[model samples]
Target: MPLCFQELVTPLLIDGAVSPLSPQSPLSASFTSVLPYHKDSGILSEAEAKKAQKALADGNLLEVVFAAIETLRRVPSTRVNIAVTGDSGNGMSTFINALRGIGHEEEASAPTGVVRTTQTRASYSFSCFPDVVLWDLPGMGATSQSLEDYIVEMQFSQYDLFIIIASEQFSMNHVMLAKAIEEMGKKFYIVWTKLDMDLSTRMLTEGQLMKNIRENILENLQKTRVRKPPIFLISSLEPSWHDFPKLRDTLKEDLSDIRYHGPLQNLFHAYKEIINDKVTYLQEKIATNSFQNTPGMRDIDDLAECLKTYRLSFGVNDESLQQLARSMGKESSEYKAIMKSQDLQAVITRGWKLKCLTCRVMKMFLILLSYIPSLDALIAPYIRQEKHNRMLEGVAEDTMTVLKKVLKDFTSS
Candidate 1:
């Protein structure tokens, strides 16, 4: 590591961020009271405080603290860091990109390729939020290493989940990874890749294929001595092909609630709430303060500035939202009912009501120009008038007005 990077990543190698936490440290307050485990379940909660206590009590306070900090200090986004590993041509990279909502197989949103990709643990963050990284790791094979080495080296517990990719039946490698993850009390799932290829061959119907896949997963788990195993069937080409939403829901459900979900959500909520509380407190103080030497004029100016900032932040600008809504339409599909209604109106009314308004505005502007009183004197007789400029401006303005109307009508109706 470079000198600067060494300083930056030193915290990750130590215990979770709690070991060096001083009472006055910037991030200390977050870990002091909170715990990683739940009160009722006694499992590590998401809160840094509780995890820190666990570390201290176990005499491995440094490790837990570092881990907690790593989780908390992690980019403020839901990146489910999944280590996807399977045999060659299994489509692990393609699956990752699809899950993150990227485009085609070759032009995946996540990084992948056939260069023995991901020789080391490399993270591919979601475009929506870079913090949600997916790790494309080296495929599993028979190497002279114990399962414990795999668990520790990979830091299995730090990941939100594990996605074991396989094209056909869950293989021995997948079974080993799954069993190890289970033993370590972590979450893992099997993703059956290349389903499209199988379907093309007419080997089995979709339903039959799914049943066989499930049975194979069970068989693999049994072979590995795992009692029960959870599996997800997926095709990167069709991220929404089969139970994608269900898969997402299951992962969220399995996370350490108090430590991962509850504390994370709470931290964001609390940060916002604290800022709000401070604003309320200041308002009360101002209201109760004596008028003398209070600099009321300055206060009024500050209040106006504050109100302006608040309005800009919270109050939606219909114009901007209309533009955004139109841009969004380019990527997203609109409701059939709404699209049908608009198309009908466009046919009957010659595009939209705003088209009429546009015509009126155009006619009015032309009428004003007519009053220029120059008649033929203002222009050379050979300079023929062209409606192109007027038409272009009118079309642009009309489009904006139509977008606004569409947005308003949809929101209201």
Candidate 2:
């Protein structure tokens, strides 16, 4: 008969009892060989695991888990804002439309014309990219506003990236804008528009004209100390020509890197914060309990029991580990091998051996401390608390080991 899920995991969970489920009860021989790499692949390190354990011992798990969940929920909604700004009649709207892979006539396209059509900051979404918005900002120096005031009013700090558009030679206004963006430690691209017009009107070869334009732009930027900002020469009417294709590809790549890494970084930070909070709570609990004179308060049985409880709480139990393995389409034994903790049931069954040893050591220490008079009461509670903390640390480390294994399996699969 085929084994039920509970039956499959039961032997693995049982203390000191070998399962007949397979030749290797908890894990296959092959999985044991690769277990070391699983430890290293997780987002948290052994040091971080120790910190987390301390936090859990000192703090509340429920609050940390809630904060982590809330932070993760916000990740999907995180928006990458890109701003396109330049002088009026510089094809900012047309460039935006082209960048979004939509024609100017399309209902969703930014309004395009010879005059200043984008009066205010109008946002458009990229169909191919989710949670990314492109803002077609009103032209700089369009009215009596100073360049600095224009930047402030437009809220230049809001955008993650900036695309500055120009049709002709890079003007003094363009240089100032580039300098301002550079001073603020922001990234911007210089796009020389109307390449098609220049190619048709100029007698010079396309290569020569492009070379001259690029050199001229670079020289002007150098004057304002704007070093090596990405400059692209392209025609809005013919995006296929010049650097338009490269520009599009580069933007996508940049956005992809930001989108992928941003959330992971934020989540990593949130995990640290949660762990810290947990540690604080655990510390307070330990201190308060240490001060109590009652025999129940000094007992270490509850501390020993926490190891098994923590393993189950972190989904490191045989059943949870097996479920994770099944989700990844791997054998249950393969997942079990990566776990750092002993089987929960096995630990419970054989726990009395360790408990006996611990009790003997504590009794011997107390007898010796009793002769020290004033120091006995002062130091005994702290010693007991330290032992409990060490057990908690071990449990926390095992929890992290199992978590890392699950994360590695999911990402690789």
> lDDT winner among the candidates?
2
Consecutive 10-residue window with the lowest summed lDDT within model 1:
1-10
TM-score, candidate number 1: 0.42
lDDT by residue for model 2 (1-413), tens:
21111111111111213221212211112222322221331344555444333333322232223333333334454588888988888889998887777787878889988767888888998775657889998987567789888888899998888899988768888888889988887778999989999999999999999999999988988986787888899988877779987888677656644553554554444444443343344445566773243233344445544554444433355665555454445676775665445543434243454354356676798889989979987987776666555544444555455444443332222
lDDT of each: 0.47, 0.61
lDDT of 1 by residue, 29-103 (tens): 222333233343222344654443443322232233244345454534344566776654577767776766665
Which window of ten consecutive residues has the lowest lDDT sum in model 2? 2-11
Q: In candidate 2, which residue ranges exceed 4 Å CA deviation?
A: 1-74, 264-413
Q: Please, what is the TM-score per model?
A: 0.42, 0.50
RMSD values, in order shown: 23.1, 15.1
After aligning candidate 1 to the native by TM-score, how far in Å is the CA of 48 from where it should be? 17
